[model samples]
Target: MRIPRIYSAGDLAENTSAELDAAASNHVGKVLRMKPGQSLILFNGSGVDYTATITCVTKKHVIASIESATEIPSESPLATHIGQVMSRGDRMDYMIQKSTELGATEITPLTSERCEVKLKGDREEKRVKQWQQIAISAAEQCGRSKVPLIHPITSVDDWVDNKPEDSLGLVLHHRTTQQLTGIDKPQRVCLLIGPEGGLSEAEIESAINKQFIATTFGPRVFRTETAPVAALSVLQWLWGDFNR
Candidate 1:
């Protein structure tokens, strides 16, 4: 059987025994029905994988003993950050999950002129935590050693303005003739995508003034959730591990 992989929040060390947090414990004891003596791999976004064997499983707790730890070099050399405008329903969840699987290093949910989702206070906090867990699950399934960072919701202009100087920024729109293939490979890329109705003309212009190049896939316009997957995949193929 394929040993299930899980994400642990606390630090793990070789030959150490630790009690898993409630979420992990619940998953191990209730959801997965994992029993004592079964082996599982654990990662904490620390770039290390710990081979662990369950020592105890109970209604409220699960304990594991770390057998060994190994470094995982699964990260892509090309760092890609996506600034995605917020969407409704499960679209944001879908976008975050697929983006993590596609090797996006960081994700910043944006509030745009056309944004449909509004989050604030406790609701926003809860939503971000939910999105973060989705990223963790994606990392586990994809064999990624490190989980992608999910940032708090911010405005499109704020996100674009705060990008690192060396990051090559690209804003997706329908009018642009520029394509991903036309650009030279950079060490990092910060892609800006709009919401359901798409970014406003002024929003696109602000991104351009901030040195973000306008990019278009074709005449077709992709949904907020679907565009990131296609764009990131193409970018990975061109500049990341797909080339290897």
Candidate 2:
């Protein structure tokens, strides 16, 4: 039988016992109904998975003894950072989950001119925490040893101001004459996607002025949530780790 894998926030070391967090304990004890002496794997997003067996099970807690660890390398050779404008409802959540599964190294939720999802104060913090959790769970399910970092929500203008010079930066805009596959080999890339309503003309112009190249994915228009995943897939097929 295949052992169930769980992602925890605790420190893991070989020949040591680590207390499973309450959430994981509940999952193993109640959800999975894993009894003592059963085997499972644990990962702390440290690029290694700890092989462990259940040592004790009680009403209040569950403990596992680590047997050994298998070192896992990072997924992608060419890193892609997706800078997506926040969309409404579950749109952003779906984007983050699928992007993590597709091997996006980093994700930034940008608040752009067309963003309809307004978050203020505590709500912003709550949403960021939720999105980060989604990313972690997606990594765990998708067999990624390390979870992608979900950056704190920021404005589009601020993000454009701090973009790195060495990375290839491209924005998804229909007006652009260039296709995504036309780009040459680049070690790292940053993808900028607009919100549901799409980026205003002025916003696109401003991004172009700041040296962000625009690229399209053929003639059909894709939704805000779907655009990043399509672009990432094409990018991976053309010049990234997917070719391996």
Maximum-lDDT candidate: 1
Worst 10 residues of 2 by lDDT: 175-184
lDDT values of the candidates?
A: 0.92, 0.87
Question: How many residue pairs clash in all the candidates, one count each?
Answer: 0, 0
Candidate 2 wrong stretches, greater than 4 Å: none
Please write out the lDDT profile of model 1 over residues 128-148, one tens digit for every residue. Answer: 999999999899999999999
Tens digits of per-residue lDDT for model 2, 1-244: 8888888889999999988988778888888898889998999888899999999887768899999999987588878999899998899899999999889999999998888988889999999989998998898788888888999999888887777888888889976778755567888888889998898888787777888898888888899999988998988888777878
TM-score of each: 0.97, 0.93
Task: List the pairs of residues colliding in candidate 2.
Answer: none
Off by over 4 Å in 1: none
